[model samples]
Target: MAKILKSTDLECFQQQGYVRIPEAFSPVDALAMQDFIWDKLEEKCSILRSEPNTWDKHVTGLNKSAENTIYSDIASQRMCRAIDDLLGEGTWEIPKKWGSFLVSFPQKLNHNWTVPTNHCNGIPWHWDG
Candidate 1:
């Protein structure tokens, strides 16, 4: 059985259209998962390095092979718990398009990176969807 979300959590999600789960997973657990992902990535890199011609069929941007494992055991458990908590039992469904993970490396900016702006057309537009 999962813990029930508080009234405040429901209200916040309704108002903002998204809710942040603070400290949902421990820092230690997160770092361990990250290390696991890096290990898989390194293995893929090594395989590509050893066989140059196989690169065309296997490697993509950042050497990320399409078939490479994305979700770790810990991550899968966390996501399952989150889904159960948010939507109740049997409500979770696999998404048609599972997204890719991105890691942005910091580099010295050549120009002032202005924050992109967009207008929020709130609930009326959202409800119409």
Candidate 2:
């Protein structure tokens, strides 16, 4: 059922533990979702995309809106197939709604931000797999 039926992709997944699937969903849909997130960030955290000074925090958290149906289109059939390829059939559960969104910003030089020397100090380094 996987769109990436080719073994090369599977080999990449096996070796790297992740594979990128291009154009799983429409680009316009992705942009819409991005705009929605930016709007929420500005609304909730006052983190304006237009202002770089507002982007102080390295990471920001935002809650997902249940009423918005735009998030639903992200998980296309192609994406599901890719998931199936990686995780195997019926091994994964489709999300009912997007729970949370974490936005990461670049650390500004002016900010008193110290790079984490140890793993547990700040953002812990780890692989997804």
Report the C-alpha lDDT of model 2 over 2-121, residue by residue, as the tens digit: 255468888988888777788877898889888998888888778898998898865444654644787787688888888887778899988888565557776657667764555866
Question: Where is the poorest 10-residue window by lDDT in model 1?
Answer: 120-129
- The 0-to-1 C-alpha lDDT of every candidate, in the order given, reads 0.52, 0.75
Which structure among the candidates has the greatest TM-score? Answer: 2
RMSD of each: 8.8, 3.6
| Residue 26 miss distance in model 2 (angstroms) | 0.6
Give the per-residue lDDT digits (tens) of candidate 1, residues 10-125.
Answer: 67777876666655557776676576545554565442334444333333254343333433333445555665766876886755334444433243567987544533654232
Top candidate on lDDT is: 2
- TM-scores vs. true structure, each candidate: 0.48, 0.73
Q: What is the lDDT of candidate 1?
A: 0.52
Candidate 1 clashing pairs, residues 3+ apart or interchain: none
Off by over 4 Å in 1: 2-4, 22-29, 40-79, 93-100, 118-129
